[model samples]
Structures are given as C-alpha cells and as structure tokens.
Target: MEATFEAFVRARGPALLRYAHLLCGDAGRAEDLVQDALVKVYRRWGPDIAAPSAYTRRAITNEYLSWRRRLTNREVPTQLPEPATRSHTDAIAERDAVWRVLAGLPRRQRVVIVLRYYEALPDREIADLLGLAEGSVRSLAARAFATLRAHPELRDAASVDRASRAEPSP
Candidate 1:
C-alpha cells in the first residue's frame, strides 16, 4: 500500500533527519535540509510518486547538493561554532570519530557510503536516486570503503570487527 507524505514523515522523519545530519554534519542544517526537501516533495506529490521514501531521499540529497553550491559561492567564514557536550562514553566517542571521517569525504562518496551502509539500500536503488550507473555506484562504494579503511580510527574499528567475528555467540 502507498503512504501519504504526512504519514511517511511521521514514521520516517528521524531516519531522514539522521541521513541529512550525516550529509551536512550539523543538526540545525540537517533539520533545515529535511524541511526544504519535504517542501519540495509535498509540492511534487502525485500518483506517480509511488515510493515516498525514495522520492523524499532524492529530494534531501538534491537539497544538500544545492546548499553546498550556495555555500561555496559565498564569502562566509568557514569556522563552525563548537557544540556543547557532556562527557562522552567510548561508544559515543567511536561514533563521533566515524562521523568525523565521514564528514571529511567528498559528497558523492559520503552519500554512497551512507546509503549503502546506513540505509542498507541496493546498488541499483542508489544508482537510480543519484542518477549514476550501477557500475559507477559499485565503484564509488569500493573507493569510499577503501578511503574509510585507510583511516586510523577505522583501523581500530576493523580490528574490533575481526575480534567480534572470531568470537562465538553466547
């Protein structure tokens, strides 16, 4: 069955927000991005938009790309204000380190990684949303993974993953 925009948002809004946050690296900007994308999606809503989540995700991605373009054309300072934080646990620190690495990647690579790993979408779906060939999507994912694997923080994660995999389930 098809879903309405409001219902979809209500169900999936947090996931969309997380996607945007990963794309842009700021909570405020992510919220704005999601809002802007939803506005566009709401306008374009029709019977043809059978998959609201896919349509919304494409809109969010396009909005982020457009925002980056505008930011590049401006003379604003590159510095961002530091966010307030409480003492972080090891898990939080690990996630933040991963996010730092993700935020460093080029937009296409970042988006490809996020969609493939975080959203768990197939290559064909990612290609369709990004207007990329399926082979291009696979190559992008491979390159991104290579880049991520080279990071020191992720090296630790790789060791942890291996160790966990070697352990039998309780």
Candidate 2:
C-alpha cells in the first residue's frame, strides 16, 4: 500500500501541481495546496479506493476552496500595486493577461472554469467534485466566461496575438 501510494504520487504529482496552480493562480499556493491534499490522501491510502487521481484532484479542489473561504475576510490590503507593463506581442504576456483575468474571478467560478476547460471535465463530474448542482455549475461557468470575454486586458492581448499570427514573415 505504501509503495502504491508512492508510485501514485511520483506519477501524478506534477499534474496535481498544475491543477492546483490553475485553481489558485499562484505557484507557491498551488504547492501548498497539493501538499495538503497529498497528506490527507496518504492517511487513507489503501488498495480498496478506486481512481486515486480523481480522489486526489477532489482533495486539492476542496482544500483550495476551503482555504480561500478561510482567507476571504481576514486579509485586508491597504494599497493595491500598479499593474505590470507587458509587451502586447509576447505570447507569454498574452497568457499572463488571461491568467490575471482568471485570477480576478470569484473562487467557485474560477474553479468551475479550470475544471471545465483546463481539466476538460464534464459538467456532471465537476458538479460532483464541487458538491454543487449541475445547473449551478453551468451558471458559474457562464458568468465566468462572460467576465473573461469582457475583460479589456484580455481583449487587447488577444487582438495583439491575432495580429501577430496573421502577419506574414518578412
């Protein structure tokens, strides 16, 4: 059982980290989330459980959501930092812009988007993972999509990317 758990972690750790990063939008926080989830999973590690990957992912998502809820009202920043200047034509910049927009979304909405688009999970599965109704999952995704589509920075970055791609090489 211990060897099986070790093998599972070795194989799935990076993907779990990526999923956590998508959920939380910070690499450090993502690592913490994955670590916490793995600890929880390790306690229950046994051959009887089916689909350890799904179980671990659900654990990570639950940890992220609960952590966000705990921190939601406690942290109060006195001042906001100015946004960083980014080159419009840089693909990395475009991805950063999109990530910024995603980071701005409410936690549940962001989770829904990450699960639906990034993880490519069906609505039913997402709903089950989140303990939300399927209709609520759809509504959250709709709102998140609308917010992403309406973000100005994302719009500008996308246009720049499109123009860059469309230009013929000199």
Whole-model lDDT values for every prediction? 0.76, 0.78
| Clashing pairs in model 2, backbone N/Cα/C closer than 3 A | none
Those runs of model 2 whose alpha carbons end farther than 4 Å from true positions after fitting are 72-88, 156-170
As for candidate 1, its clashing pairs are none
- Give the lDDT of residue 67 in candidate 1: 89
State how far residue 139 of model 1 sits from its true place (Å).
1.1
Query: Candidate 2 versus the native: TM-score?
Result: 0.79
Q: Which stretches of candidate 1 lie over 4 Å from their true place?
A: 1-3, 73-88, 152-170
Error at 157, model 2, angstroms: 8.4
lDDT of 1 at 153: 67
| Candidate 1 local lDDT, 1-170, one digit each (tens) | 22666788899999999989778877788999999999888888888898889999999999988888688543222223344356745555666666777677778988887787667787789999999998998788667666666788674676335422332221
Q: lDDT of candidate 2? A: 0.78
